[model samples]
Target: MPSLGADMEDGTLTDWMVAVGDSVSRGDIVAVVETQKGAIEIECFEAGPVTDLIAREGDVVPVGAPLAVIGEADASDPNRTEIQAPPADPTPEPVTSRPQDPPVPSVPEAHEPTPIGTADASMSDAAPQQIRQSAEEPKASPAARMRARDLGIDLTGISGTGPGGVIVIADVEHALEDVTPARPLRHQKDAMRQAIAAAMVRSKQTIPHFYLSHTMDAQPAIDHVTRLNADRPPSERILPGAVFLRATALAARDCPDLNGHDNGEGFVRADAVNVGLAIALRGGGLVAPAVMEAAELSLAETMAAMRDLVARARTSRLRSREMTAGTITLSSLGENGADAMAGVIFAPQVAMVGLGAPHKRPWVVDGTVQPRTVVTMTLSVDHRANDGRKASQFIAAFETHLNRPDAL
Candidate 1:
């Protein structure tokens, strides 16, 4: 099973997409595994015909365990040789232990396609194991297998859309959408809660955390977005969250300390700004998927990616790249959430920025009372990587971005 997250250990192999004799290529979605984070599509790194399927469906295996063996394709074929073999070995003398003038590469053995678990047919117990293995191997990825299990859909009958006929999570989901035993929301939520607990425990136990809070006026940002959207279609309208994400990313330029991971040895700064957006899932869980290179994207591009990320995250459609792409995190509570939020730092990441719901409040501007849209922004920093002074400056830069929303 592949490690879906830093916290993942053992994952249950839910299905196999390729059968024993099927040919597979590198980058194929091979199997589906169920991790605590969610069902993830496991891609194959080796390309060849499958000789053995070692991992059984619904079996929980540790990370790095072999799921299947990819056999060499016609190893004995002359066309497979890269360098030409010299002619005239016909006059060769008797074999001796002494080394030759120039060493020759050894010829590899030829292999015919074998059934699942029958690659080594000489083993005494091969027949019984082979029968069981052949009955269970269907060539699906771990995530696809888990989804099949959850939805009570049989993998043996479904066709895979992934490379090399490997069934992926999407294929299983489409099957489930048409027919299923029951929705497994409660069970999934419980599993997600456990995963969150383990991660938070690890985060607080090791990382030295400190807090910073600041309140800023939100009128400029709100007005800027409203004016920009006035002439555009409803689909192109920008949300307030996009402004917050872009501003936080821009602040990283001046405060580089807030934008990387601390992997025990030392801090390794990231060259790009992939800001993870903390989204609350509808099934009573949360996931933070990154918006790749947030600082470099225009306001419209950021909003478009944010919309796509949130939609995929909630529906369990996130890819491996998005899940592991975070350099730093940004979280917010929209209109109904708390006035201010104090967030815990995700481990390895040096900082997290949280935004509270923006509300209208009375403010004294030039000796006159005026209603202004204001929001409370909180910055959670890792004390080992940065101090309160730098944290203050980072927040100040963030506020500055919010004040000039046109530049964002």
Candidate 2:
């Protein structure tokens, strides 16, 4: 396995998209390797036939171990990326069933004991870690030891998941998660959790964040989505989230400054706006996968992209590209109806708008009071980039757009 990066020492072979005997062209994905972050597609650097696959799916081999042999011994075929697969069990053949002839004579055990220290030293060198552990020394990893210490559980009693019985944190977590109801379901949070944690920490600490909230009537958007989905099939129903994406994109377009990045001296703007929709995963956490050039997509187009994005996000198939490069973001707590929430602005991006829960409240319209559905939007801006007036104007234009949703 070639070293993917500095942080990665090993990778799990998630899947082999191309199998042995399949012709692999340049840029064709041969396998998917799952690092700590997520699964990344491994493409062939050279065009040739796939011959040998030393590592099967789920193998965690060391880096630069030549996981699969490439280039034939003869260098015969121009298309040969690797040599043919060798026969299985190529090691020196060992006797399968021993001969049934008379066995060798057995030696008698000596009753006399050698020097105790010398014999114990020999045993320590000969036997594995299990034989060496005592009341003084623990044969577990730091994680295992820490967990054992914290929980008042002995590592010696728990089975290890690490290599060569080196107790690991997972073995402890598994044992705890199964038996203890107190321990949270940490398994649900994986790579994305770490990514989010790092991002939130960086954003909160490094970036100066400020929030501007606006509560507007939701009837326009509701009517718009209903009308859009009226003639179309059920599968093509336009969700409010789609409208939110379109509105955010349009707002970005109106306020070019918000859609751009700070280049030290002046602002550098992006040509097309991409909006990230923050979606909550099943158990916990959230993923914000962006849809590129959302400003240009029609209602139907935005709906389709929204459907696909949500699908990919839930499946953990969202790539790094899908998660980045958003000029702005629109996070919806739809029906999640949080009255209004302050959302963290993803760094490097200028702004993020959070869509709050839609609820009915009494409102006065030209001296007449009526109940209406209202949804609040909180805009989180990077203070260093744009002032409050620019933010207010963008929200005004966005509200106008939402009011005239039929034109969308």
Candidate 3:
């Protein structure tokens, strides 16, 4: 058994394609293993006569555990092969079946003559050739081997389609398409998706949410960042997100009610200030990795932490400590230039704030029109925990935090 994911240790053998007395070639699909994520096909790592099958089907094997042995069944008997290997090796050296490196390679066909002599023990006994490990082994193709390597599927468990039992890439594709008694492919991906689904459902259905929107000037803050990063090293530039996180933390401290939730029985106040920053992955899917004790960190520190968190989250390497338990949430759809994005509250979190892209618009300035960086912020608050007035105050305070960010 081989490891599939960072958290996965052992995998259950889903099924076996090859049995004792079955002949297999290198890169052949042999077995299917069920890992946390899905059912993955296995390919043979070596081309040899499988003299013995150690582990049977449905066994949970750890990574690097011995699964079987490959070698000549018997030196004296030319016909001898692993139960998984063919009855006889037409090719004198089994290794010939395997192609050399793609750059320069040799491919040898089965050595048996067009008219292979009858399988007669009388002739073999007369001139006995000492059986070597290579003569009796089954071999698979290189491409098949690579697939199994990444998927962590054992080749002995799979059957092959190529002539002489050679495993091919198509074989792996077809195997993944077929469904079995165990979980189908993408089980782990579906599992993670379900977890996210549950979180969304809990937040939407159970929580009573209220909406609040406001537009604040960003000129001051933009200049503030410019001044801070002016003489600083490129690596030490102040980030806009850090300013937002720091300001949100400060606003939450002032309007504790917005920071807390109404847990039906009463208003529940969270002792810690964990803020979940929503991150959008490249392909799709969104994850909110949290920044703990946001109130305690300075603007620069918060910026550094948020940057690191987003990087790790994109790589799917975020630790458990980086997930959930935020008092308030921030969703940034600014890159998409969405006028506004209404956030779905994650359960227990009183409210979520979404930021829209800032665009220059001409507004009436005294009787004349003037340009300004117009932006929108939407706050989705749980109605169970807060009312319109409370939501309004929270939004007001949030706008103030941005309006006079220096004070914040």
Report per-prediction Cα RMSD to one decimal.
16.0, 15.4, 22.1
Candidate 1 structure quality by residue, lDDT tens digits, 1-408: 444554443567887878887887755777777776776666665566776787899986644456676774455644321111112111111011002211111111001122443212111111232212233566654444544554567888888765466665557756765674555775577568856764565467556788999988899999999899999998999999999999999998668888877654446677888898999987588888789889999999999999998877766666555566577899999977888997877766789998999989897667998899899999999888889999999999999999999999
- Candidate 3, residue 401: Cα displacement in angstroms equals 1.5
Whose lDDT is greatest here? 1
* Candidate 3 lDDT trough over 10 residues, lowest sum: 85-94
Local error of candidate 2 at residue 273 (angstroms) = 1.1
Error of 2 at 254 (Å): 1.5
lDDT of 2 by residue, 43-128 (tens): 55556556678788888654333345444534466654432111111111101101121111111101112222221111111113
By TM-score, who's the top model here? 1
Output the better candidate (2/3) by TM-score: 2
Position 123, candidate 2: lDDT? 14
Where does candidate 2 clash, by residue pair?
A: 337-357
The sequence of per-residue lDDT tens digits that candidate 3 reaches over residues 1-408 is 433321223456767767666667766766666643345556664566666666778886643455555566664666543222221111111122221112101123322211222222111111122111133434444434434443555556466766566655445544654533456434446544534553564355456666888877666676788788999997788777677777778777777877754433455777767787988766556777678788888878888888888887666555323443467888876534777778897555678888887767775656887786666888898776678887788777777877776764
